[model samples]
Target: MAVPGWLDDTRTSYDTVAVSYADLLRDALAAEPFQRGILALFAELVRAQGPGVVADVGCGPGRITGYLDGLGLDVLGVDLSPGMIGVARRDHPGLRFEVGSMTRLDLADDSLTGLLAWFSLIHVPDDEVPGVLAEFRRVLRPGGVVLLGFHAGDGSRLKTEGYGGHPMHVHVHRRRPERVAAWLEAAGFTVEAELTHRPAPDVEGGFVFAHR
Candidate 1:
C-alpha cells in the first residue's frame, strides 16, 4: 500500500521520541506475559531453522534483533523508519541495524539464511505483500525460512491508529494465515508450521513459519 503522507513526519517525530519509545516497549514487554510468550515463540522459530544469518524486518528498537544476537546468530535489524533505527543503534550498539524498506531489500539474492517479519508487514497494502514476500524469497537461500507475524482476520485500515504514543497515525492491514501462506508458496516458499495467539487482551494473530 502507498504510505500515507503523514508517515514521513511520523518518522521524523519518532526520531525525536525514539529513546522514550524504546524504553516504554522494553519495560512493557519485560513485564507483559503475552509479550514474553510472543518472544519465546520467536526464539523457538529461529532455533528450529538452525540459523546462520537472520534479518528482522521492521525491527523497531532492535528488541528481537538483540534476542537473536544473544543466541549467537548473526542478525541485522531493518526498518523503514530511520528514527527507529537510530534508537535501535543507541540501545544496542553491539548489533547491526539498517534503514530500508521490506518491499526492496538491498541484500544480495539468496544471501540470507532466515527472515523474520514481526508485525512489520501490517502497514503494507494487501497487493504489495506479494512483492515484499518475493523480495524475502530473493534474499533467502533456497531452503531458508521466513517467519511472519500479522494481525488476524481481514482487518481494515480504520481499526488501528498510531502506535503507543508515537506522533504518526499507524495503519493496520490484517490477513489470514492461510492466505499469506498461499502467497509464500506462490513466491516459492514451502508452507511449514503455523501458530496462533492473542497477545493483547482479545486481540489475536498468528505466526506463519515457512521455508524458501
Candidate 2:
C-alpha cells in the first residue's frame, strides 16, 4: 500500500528534527504540574486494572514513554519516524521503541491495554483522524484505555520550521475536545474525561481519556 503524502511529510519532518526535538522537550513535563498530574492520573488508572501492556504511540524521543516506565507501567514506545525511534532508543536504552504509524498500526487485534498519543495527532489532518481512532479501537482490548493529547483549537496550520530552525513540512491540526470525543464515540470508545490546559499563553493543550 502506498503511504499518504501527508504521512510521509510528517515522518520526514520529524526525522529531520528528532535530535533537537528530543533535547528541547526532554524535561518539558517537569515544569508542568498539571500535565504531569494528568499523566500520573492516566498511569494510576491503568495500574488499578492490574498488569497490562501500554504503548505510547507517536512517542517522539521516548521522553514520556520513559516517564511512564518509571511510574512502573510495562510501556513501549512507537512512532512513525525512524529518526525519532533511534533517538528514543539511544536516550532510554532500557525501553522498547518501534517505528510505526498510528494510521495503520502493526499491532494485533485487541492486543493493547492502554495507549497514549500525546501531541502526535496534531500532524494528522482532521479527515484522517477517524481512521486513526478506528485503528486505535481495533488494537485495544475490550476494557482498554486511551489517552490523547493535542493542541486545543479549531484550525490547521503548516509548520515549515521546527526545533532550532530545522526545515519541516507538516500541518499542525488543532482540534476541540468535544470534536475529538465525538470521533471517539463513533469509533466505539466511551469518553471518560477531558482536560484543557494552557501550557502556554497562546497554546491550549487538550487531553481526552476514554475506554473501549
The number of clashing residue pairs in model 1 is 1
Candidate 1, residues 38-116, lDDT tens digits: the string is 5566566656667567899989898878876876668999988898998899889999999988878989997888888
User: Pairs clashing in candidate 1?
Assistant: 1-125
* Stretches of model 1 off by over 4 angstroms after superposition: 1-17, 31-51, 158-164
**TM-score per model over all chains:** 0.84, 0.97
Tens-place lDDT per residue, model 2, 1-212, is: 12259989999999999999999999988998998899999999888767889999999999999999988999989999999999999999999999999989989998888999989988887778889999999998888989999999888778999899999999888889998999999999999998899867897999999999
- What range of 10 consecutive residues in model 1 has the weakest lDDT sum? 158-167
Each prediction's Cα lDDT score? 0.77, 0.91
TM-score between model 2 and native = 0.97
